[model samples]
Target: MSVTMSPGRYRGLRNVSLPAADTFGIVAFDQRGSYRKMMGAQASYAQLCQVKSEIISALSQSASAVLTDPIYGMDAAMRMSPRAGLLLALEKSGYSGDSSYRKTELIPSWTAQTICQVGADAVKFMVYYHPESGVLAEELEALIKQVVARCHACDLPVFLEPMSYSLDAAVPKASAEFAAARPAIVIETARRLSRIGADVLKLEAPHDIAHNQDEAAWQASCEQVSAASAVPWVLLSAGVDFAQFERQLRVACAAGASGFLAGRAIWKEAATMSSAARANFMAEVAARRLDALLEIAARDARPWSDFYTLPQFDATWYEAYALC
Candidate 1:
C-alpha cells in the first residue's frame, strides 16, 4: 500500500536535500523540568546538568537537528546555553485559565521575537493540543495564521503539531479508554486539520494491539491521516518499548509519514547522569535510534526484527536520560 502527504507547509529548518520519499528526521527534547525550572545554577544541581548534557551531546553527534523546549521556560533554560537551535514549544494562549495573562505572557511575544532573533536559522515553533481546547476551527485557524504572520514578519519557520483525534479536556478521564477510542476518531480529525492551514501534523499511534486492534487497523488510520492532511505527517512516540516502538515507526513510514517528533525516549536515559556525561550518553543512543528509524523509513517492506537482535535499552534509561 502507498501513502501520501502534502509538503507545502514545512518551514524554518533547512530543507533536507534528500527526496521526500527518502527523508526521515528525528527530533528529541525535554519539556517537563530541565535547567529552565531551577533559577540558581548550583553544584548540587545535578538534575539540570544531566538533562542539558544529554541534549547537547545528542545535537553534536546526530545529523538530526534537535528541537529543545524550555522544559520550564526559555529564560531559565537559556541561562545554561541560550544559543542552541530550539523549538519554542509555544503554550496555547487560553488554556492556562488566564485570558489576561495570554495577552501579557512571554509565549506569544517571545516566540515571535526569538524567531526573528534566530533569523534564517529559525527553529520550529510547535503548539501541542490546540484543537482539543474547545477552540473552533475558524478561531484556531485565525490564531495559527496570526502566529504564521508573526513568523513571516520575523522570517521564522512555524511547525504546528495537530492531533488526528480530539480528547476531552476534563481531568480524571480514563487514559486507557481514550487510547482505545482514539484511532477511529483521528481519521476525521486529520481531515479537518488539513483544511485549517496546519503546517505539520503529529499523531499518536493506535493503541489496540490485538487482532481486534491490530497493526493493520493502525496502518489504515495512518492512510486516512496521510490522505486527509494537507501537510506533512510526523508520528509521535507513544512511550512503548523498543519492539513496539519500532513497529509503530514502521507503520508510520509505510503509511508515508515524513518522520517523527520524539521526546521521553531520548532524554529519559540521562536523568540521573552528570550534566556532561548525560549529554554524551544521549547523543550516542539518539544517533543509534535515528539510524535505525531512518533505515525503517527508507524501506519498502516492514522488516520485523527478532527481539534478541535489538539493542538493550530499557525504561530506566529513559527515566534517567530520555525525559526532562
Candidate 2:
C-alpha cells in the first residue's frame, strides 16, 4: 500500500527515489576517524575517497541510495555515480578524543540550504547518545531542533542517527554490561529523537547475538524500538560481519524495520585487501554482498512510507515547497 504525505514530505521522499517496487537499500560510506582506525596506520584521506568511490560505482547500481561524507568522499561519490540517491553526512566525528565514547559535532560549513544546493537527497547527522553521558543529550537535542526546522523550511529530508556508547572508560566496549543496556537505550533514544521531529531514524539492532541470543527476546526488543519511533526507521550495521548483519536484518525487518542504511559490513573486508585487489573485490565480493542484502529487504522489509500516517498540507505548503 502507498502512503499519502504533505508536499514537503513527498518532496523529501522523492529525493530518496528508490526504484519502484523495491525496498530501501542505502549503501553508507560516511565514516571518518573510526574508518581510519579500521583501515590501520596506512589509511589516508585520498585512499578513503578512492575506496568509497569504487564501492559506489560497483555496488550502488543495485542499491537504492548512497550515504557520503562531505569531508572526503562526497565529490568522488557524486562524480562516480551520478544516478544514485545521495545522503550527505553533516557531523564531524571524534570530537571527544576518547575511544570509548564519541561526542558528535555538526560541520561548521554545511546547512540545510547548502546541502540542498549541493543536490543531496537528504542530510544525516550521527549523534552519540547515552542517558548518562552528562550534558551531551541536552546539547544534541538543541542542535537537532535547529536542523529539523531548517530542513523543513528547505523541504529537505533529515535523518537522525543516535548511536550508544559506554561513557565509563573502565567498561569494555564489547562487555555484556554494554550489550545488555543497549536495547533499552536504543528504544528510548528513538522515542526521544522522533518526538523532536526527525524525518527518518538510523538505528542499531536492539539485540546482539553475542549477548542476547534468544530469538523471542530479539523480537520483543525490535518490537519496542518499532513502537517507540514516531517516524520511519532503518537499521545500521555498526561494523558487524556481513553474515551476522544479514541475520540481524532478517529479524529486524520481520519485527518492523523499514530497511537498512549500512556500511562497513558490506565492504570492510575489501578495505583490508591489497590496493591491486580492492577494485576486483568491490566489483565481485562487495557488490554481491550488497545485492544479497537488497534481496532480503525486497523479500522481507517494510516500505518506509507505510510506517507513518498520511499528512495533509494546505495550499501554502505546496506553493512554497512543491517540486514542479
Point to the candidate with the largest TM-score: 2
> Where in model 1 is the C-alpha error above 4 Å?
1-13, 16-22, 33-50, 70-86, 92-95, 98-108, 119-138, 163-174, 206-213, 275-280, 298-324
Q: Which candidate should be chosen as best, given lDDT against the real structure?
A: 2
Write down the TM-score for model 2.
Answer: 0.89
For all predictions, the C-alpha RMSD in Å is 12.2, 3.0
* Candidate 2 lDDT by residue in tens digits, 1-324: 334555555655655645563346888888878778877787777887777677667767777878888877776667755567778888876566575556677778877778888877788888888756657778778888987888767777788988888878877657898888889889998888888977889999988678877878888898899888887788999889899888888888888887899988998877667766988888778888888888877777777767544567676654555431
> 135-234, model 1: which lDDT tens digit per residue?
5545655666676666545544455654332344442123556566666556555666655544455666644443234778778878777776665666
Return model 2's CA RMSD, one decimal: 3.0
Report the lDDT of model 2 for residue 141.
84
- Model 2, residue 166: displacement in angstroms? 1.8
> Model 1 — which ten-residue stretch has the worst lDDT?
301-310
lDDT of 1 at 44: 45
Backbone Cα, N, C clashes tallied per candidate: 21, 0
Pairs in steric clash, model 2: none
